[model samples]
Target chain A: MAEEITTTEEKTVDKDIAALLTSPPKRAPEPTPELTGKIVKPKIVQGAAAHYKPHVAKPEIQEKLGFPGTLVENWQEAAVAKMRELLGKYKSLQVYMDICVRCGSCTDKCQYFLSTRDPKNMPAGRAELFRQVYRKYFTTEGKIFGKLAGAVDFDLSLLAEWYSYFHQCSQCRRCSLYCPYGIDTAEISMAAREIMDSIGLGQKYTNEIIGKVHELGNNLGMNEAALRNAIEFVEEEIEEDTGVPVKLPINEEDAEVLLVTPSADFFATPHLESLVGYAKVFHQAGINWTLSTTAAEAGNFGMFVGSYYHMQKIASRIKQAIEELRPKRLVVGECGHAWRVAYAFWNTLIGPFDMLNQKYPRPQHICEFTLDLINRGALKIDKSANDEFVVTFHDSCNVARATRMGDKPGGQFDIPRELIKAVTNKYVDMEYDTIRERTFCCGGGGGLLTDELIDVRVKGAMPRMQALHNVMETHGVNFMALICAICKAQFTKIMPKYGIPMEVAGGVHQLVGRAIVLGAKE
Target chain B: MSGLTLLYTLFAYVAIAVFLVGFLARIWKYATTPSPLKIPLTPAPVNSVGVVYRMVQEVGFFKSLFYSNRIIWIGGYLMHIALLITIVKHLRFFFKTTPAALAWITSFEIYVGFIFFGALAFLFLMRLVIDRTYYLSLMQDYVLLIFLMLIAATGILTKYYVRTDIIKVKQFVMGLVQFRPEAIPGDPIFIIHFTLVLLLLIYFPFSKLMHSGGIFFSPTRNQVDDAREVRHVTPWAVKG
Candidate 1:
């Protein structure tokens, strides 16, 4: 009885703080009604429009962007040398050359191929380009009867073709599944991209994003102040919705958990709701969690850019943030590629972190977090809130099968489904060919989420759109909930184009925001 | 039965057991290993027609077969296909005894024997004569190839030259399959050859031969490249 009274008093104190933070006397004029509608359209949003527009190369900006190019002294020469070195490494290129039986099983497997309806996008042809070169360089018949075998010399024209063909690939391991010999063309592409980037021929957009991440500590140029303001803003929004002032604690000194998310959420819509979802859960659970303005983003573009150094450097910011905050656990935000890089590679680089005097705890994604709450019976959610539509999950490639076991690294997918079941009415899966490891790509993977690649992204997203359209047409799926920030942003932008006007929620966290009945008496 | 034939049968059964156990074990391990990432890294198609054209060209036209190191690609594939088809054709023996409608697909085993033995001969010659290949080929690789060639050669000789009693051969095999007592092969050479073949079978699961099986489990090739778009959470991913 005494504990109940004290809890009520504490609730009253929180309500007082919430009142002060929100409903500020003379609240700023409704964000100018123009910005509200404009926010949904990338073109209408001036900031996003300007950011997305193809960067007009300015001499000064170029000067700032310019750096001593990669280790290769010359682009073409170095590329040739690298190609020769790779070709020479294998005792017999036979394992790679003869591996492709070309059952055409992998033809429809590429996101780009499906998106563009182009044949070269097929993994078989991409490999043939290299195979031809291998033949010419190493085979006797290829030396004498090159045309018969489609073998050719590694010339400047071929090098140019390699650049064009290679960049078109996202290095997504989708084709690897259908490949009979387990040949990952993506690994080959990574090596190819690294070779190209070494010669200062890296894609401008990918390089710029990597540069931006380096400069501002995020893929977007969101600074510490903007991040803090975004967190504070989301906190207010959650308070308005729940009558509970959820703390999106930013850089709270000595917090138990350092929750890191992609900066895209602060600026984007669907993921913004996801942010609120997380805040609401922490508020209800009375968990000690804080968001760091620095190293706020979970998505790292360095892996896309083919820079090992950049990947390590980008991960270092997170490591440093964790060390400085000394959080008991680091919670990763909703970003797929970021999670893959973090989970797979980060522990190896900035690690053996004995200097921190603590074993680096494995990071938990937000989905894993909510599921834990549900499993522990710590949070209650009303299933009625989600009864309107039949939902299906689109598996993010990074989360599903990238690790050693090639399954869920954290045993996480079920939590999202449980959360969905708790809130939504009916859940259905896309046909067997779709969903799980067989699901379609959002087309904007591997740093294609930027505005500059909208056309390409939309085209690539066609397969997924078609699959989702088929599901919705057949089963009436209204909402597509995904965990990756890029998927949310990509689907939000491209799904509507294909008449699939479904809203993307960033995993189960969004449901918690609307469904978790807060302020319930013990 | 000659001492060589008995010794050969003993070694052959042991080899087959090891190969079957190892291969099955590896496959079980692979299938159970979970892969959830969908990062499609396959290069984009240049055009739709081009992709199909390439597939047809590579698989049907044997474009990949016309290698600079022609000896291995051509000889290796031919030998592999020949051996596989020959084994499948040999299903006549097992099926004929099952008390069902035994269809004689081919009565003349000689035709099947020629194709199998001929391909093996070509492969062995390529390995021996090809300068670069011979230099690079490991001892185990050569030994495995040689062992297969020898098995095929001995099987051919037992059928066409020696004309070993088919009933006796059947009885011996059936006894081995039933795990019962039976007389081993009378021909010492046949016994030696049979033993070597068994050793190859036992070694099958442990060697690079598993590549034929590991193809299904490789995360790189088998997972669709959807990581850029969909969020795949494995049923077994780490929880809080």
Candidate 2:
């Protein structure tokens, strides 16, 4: 009887251990009203991570950027050495790797993990992919115990995992907001991408765009003539609509302001509308603003790849433009990460703008310029002009989290909403958490907006889409206003995938354009 | 000294040395590493004073975690607070004359131990039961929690069920602090409890527990949001 009891107890303990060791398979999250927009509890789905991997950059593109043409012979050693180099270079990377207590505060905060139940998509899990390697090679415990300390050796599978999942992160920094240690996953992802690039494993979308910026002075490779023509087309269209000859000045020296905007504004719809809005604001404000052929594009792809040299190189075009044009003020148009790079990094990267007028901020956002005009009663707005559509704003991740808009701390959140409310009578915010500093990425920011990453983009957009869906159902909100060029483009492309109309996506300045009484001020 | 007492004394010295040296080295590395860019997750405080205030709120109240998930905040915050109290209570062992305030803290030791153990169990169970937490959890994560739980349980057992020579345990601890070796008390439960603590000290620097130090060094948490005003540059990135 004693022997039998002991045998049964042993069997039960083994069964419990077995159950604990084996994880359940990934399941598709059930679609519910709460999942759509109500901010429901976070649920775990198995195998939900890294469903798609983006294509790698071609050797030519890689070589142009001064990276290896192909994966090195000893890639593992190279990657590890790159990590060590980065540890010395970036305090954020080093501290983030050391700190993350995996308290699960940020687990539910990441949109990628929320959309795809893949464990690796979780911010902690994502950082762990790099931390594991850091531990094994750099730390003492990992050297002795290895797997027992959650450390793993560098291998091809791990490298492949890095490529697939790091790209999945839009580097939105939402997870960092909730992390107790403020471990920004963007810092880790940037370091990982930098390391991968060091070993010649670069993403095609970001590298290709950076190459174009290096060669053509813009992300779209538009030459000076092409850019001139695009601006002329906008000038004509605005004149026909408002009967005002709002000159879209180009390459003109002695202008009061230099307008540097994303190339998408020149070519893409909704984005172009904002470009028109900027011109109207400039024309009405009587600010002598000119577009530069050299620094035509505000969006810098160098930030996406995590290369400071390339980021500096790309940002130098704007500095060159500032030097040659000698504009009294620098006003950036609707671009997300570009604004972050300009607002947060430009001063450090290429600044001490002693030459320009100190009357204005060294680099002012276009929204800030327009909003100031409105606030000062310098510009008249017909709020009822946008009565046909109900609007809600989507805060671009970089603008919401990475940079400030005005002197106050949360001016990024208020300035855009204040602009929207100024332009339209009907405006409703998405859930409190889904907007402001706690906003979700447009699934396409951070260089993952390329055509090849469409599937990842679509899946990654689930949280934002759900938030929009809820508002659309409750308030009948027909227009989604955005400040970021990437957000506008991404929403335009992916909103249709979720059964929402593509026309719903547009720039905040698009509303500004419709409501601004152009000739009234004159 | 007997073999058992000598073995434990040697282990105590090694553990303390590893803990302090390893922790200080990690802190130094984090401190000296350069952050080339101004990448504070914004809506951040604009001044250094504000940044210090933000860090204090984050470390003291787990403010970010509170904003993130309440359940996690409760478990994590409670565990940390309980651990802090327990550490204060344990200070009586080292001091020849326990401070009046510390004597008061020792009075609540049993309650602190219960809360600590309870919070640890909840956190450990969360890793097992919650699919997301479970998937993210590693063997070391589980082991750390279980190891801590065992330490708490053994301590409670020594205090309540199996009576241990507390005076001798304090003497041994005081002797260790004073650089004089003393025989460790031959109480089985106390021995187990004390050994687990030494192991924890040895493990703390090498594991995720370095978060205590790393939190202070985290650039995102520690950096002022005045990048625009300050023109912040690092040592390596400074041009001429």
The prediction achieving the highest TM-score against the true structure is: 2
lDDT of each: 0.60, 0.86
Candidate 1 overall lDDT versus native:
0.60
Q: Per-residue lDDT for B31-98 in model 1, tens only?
A: 65444233322322223454455454444433433421244456555666666666765555444274
Native contacts kept (model 1): 0.09
Please, what are the lDDT tens digits per residue for candidate 2 over residues A311-418? 999999999998898888899999999999999999889877777787777788988889998999888789999999999999999999999988999999899889
True contacts kept of each: 0.09, 0.83
Pick by DockQ: which candidate is best? 2
RMSD of each: 19.2, 7.5
Sliding window of 10 residues with minimal summed lDDT for model 2 chain A: A17-26
Candidate 2, residues B1-240, lDDT tens digits: the string is 899989999999999999999899989988889889898878988888999899899999999988888888899999999999878788899899999988876765357778899999999988788777887887778889999999999988987789888899899999899989999999988998989999999889888899998888887878888876778788776644
Please state the CAPRI-style docking class of candidate 2. medium
Interface RMSD for candidate 1 relative to the native interface = 14.6
